[model samples]
Target: MDIRIKEAVDLFQEVMFYGTERVIKSIDDPLWKEFSPEQIQMLKLVSREKRITSSRLAALQAVHKSAISSRIKKLLQKDVIRFVQTEQQDRREKLVELTDRGKEVLVQSDKVLTDYIENLLAQHVNDEEIDQFLTIFRKLKDIIKADGVS
Candidate 1:
């Protein structure tokens, strides 16, 4: 293995440890206590996409439809999201959209994530390093995708 790759992996592990801790703290904060990290991600996607099917969402998150549906049910119960019958020609297809409350939660979560990333980038890292990190990560993604993991 390349020494640089090993060093990068070490850096990633350290950042993940601290970053996840901070984000979990934010999650546990009262304003966000009701939502899980995955739920917030789904909510944000729904808020922007306007509406999406569980099948599409599951594909996006690389999860099974049943698992996505389970989370969707919780979101519905919390009034975080709503199911809409697409007023289209397809009568059997249903869509999920974020409720107003869901959007609000997503916005809050975005702020937390943004602040966390910003802080992490600003301290002990520069723009060049950040760009390199994203490039390397994207390359890794391409390699994995080429392996037909999805």
Candidate 2:
């Protein structure tokens, strides 16, 4: 690979891996015991959609149905998620929604992560750099979306 390409790849790798690890570690707390990253992601999706089926969640999360099932089971046991019956032909089928506690956890986690990122960025870069980074990040996202990657 060209030297420029190699440098870009190295920077991307370091930023993604080391940068993400530092951010996550900065916010490590007791809530992590009850919720893994996967579970938190699933909960956020469920929170956005008033109701979502396990199958739909699996598809959205790009994981196997069994993997989603296991997470659902754990969430259910923790009382973080609950299943509600829809008025459909199959009563057995149910949609998942976050419980009150789940919502609280989600909200708390969002605040914690948001605060951590804000402080971290403030410590490392100025507002001007944030604006520039956001512009580039949004453009990169648009490019990825247009390319139909994933």
Candidate 3:
């Protein structure tokens, strides 16, 4: 294997693990105290999709339907998400959407994360470097998407 490829992969893994850990830690405010990391992740995914079927959400999260079901149940109890009946003929398929409260939570969590990232970058990285990183990241994302990796 090429040394550059190995190094890049190592760095990517390190960044993913370390950045996720730090971001989780940074959101330790009272407003976030009630949520688990997994719950927050689910909420984030739901927010992005606007509405998603439980099965599709499980697939996206690479988990079994039962696991997603448990989380969905909890979120439902909290009124963070609501199930909407799908128009499919089966009639059993339900799609999950964020409630107004869920949207508020997501917004607040995003602000907290944004502030953390902005502070971290401001302290260590310049604007030009950030722009360059974004350009490269987007290009890499496009390449991966083109390859049907997701």
Candidate 4:
């Protein structure tokens, strides 16, 4: 591999670390006490899928079914999500759906996060730079998708 490629990878890793930490801190400051990151992700997934089984959510997330148990439990306890009866009528087959409160949380959190990032970018960068950053980010996303790098 080229030395410059290696240097670029290292720089990217450092930038990602710091960037992720800052974003997580900013988002978690107000919400972390109530919900863990896993719970939030689960809520988002359920909100998107409308109705999903625990095993299916684990599969979609590429995690073990047991790994999702605690997060699902917490969401249920918080009334963010609830189990719904499926047409199959199998009581043991865990099907879950988001509650109205969960939907509101998902929408509000998205708005808050978008506004926070947009404000931060606007404060430090012009529109052209923002567009350039988005272009590069989209290219990286495409590469990741092509490589199946979930």
Each model's lDDT = 0.82, 0.88, 0.88, 0.82
For model 4, the local distance difference test gives 0.82
- The estimated TM-scores of all candidates read 0.68, 0.74, 0.88, 0.69
Cα lDDT tens digits, model 4, 32-112, are 557766677788889778899998889877799888887888788888899888878576786899999998878877776
Per-residue lDDT tens digits of candidate 2, residues 35-138? 88889889999998879999989988899999999999999999989999988999988999999999999998899888888887788899899899899889
Model 3's alpha-carbon lDDT is: 0.88
Global Cα RMSD, each model: 4.3, 3.5, 1.8, 3.7
lDDT of 1 by residue, 13-126 (tens): 997778677777754455567777678778877876789989989998789999898999999999989989989999899999887888777777778777776876698888
Worst 10 residues of 3 by lDDT: 25-34
Q: How well is each residue in 1-150 modelled by candidate 3, as lDDT tens digits? A: 899999999999999889888878766686577777778889999998888998888898889999999999998998999988987898887899999999998888888888888988999999999999999999999999899865
Which residue pairs clash within candidate 1?
none
Q: Which pairs clash (backbone N, Cα, C closer than 3 Å) in model 2?
A: none
Selected candidate, larger TM-score, 1 vs 3: 3
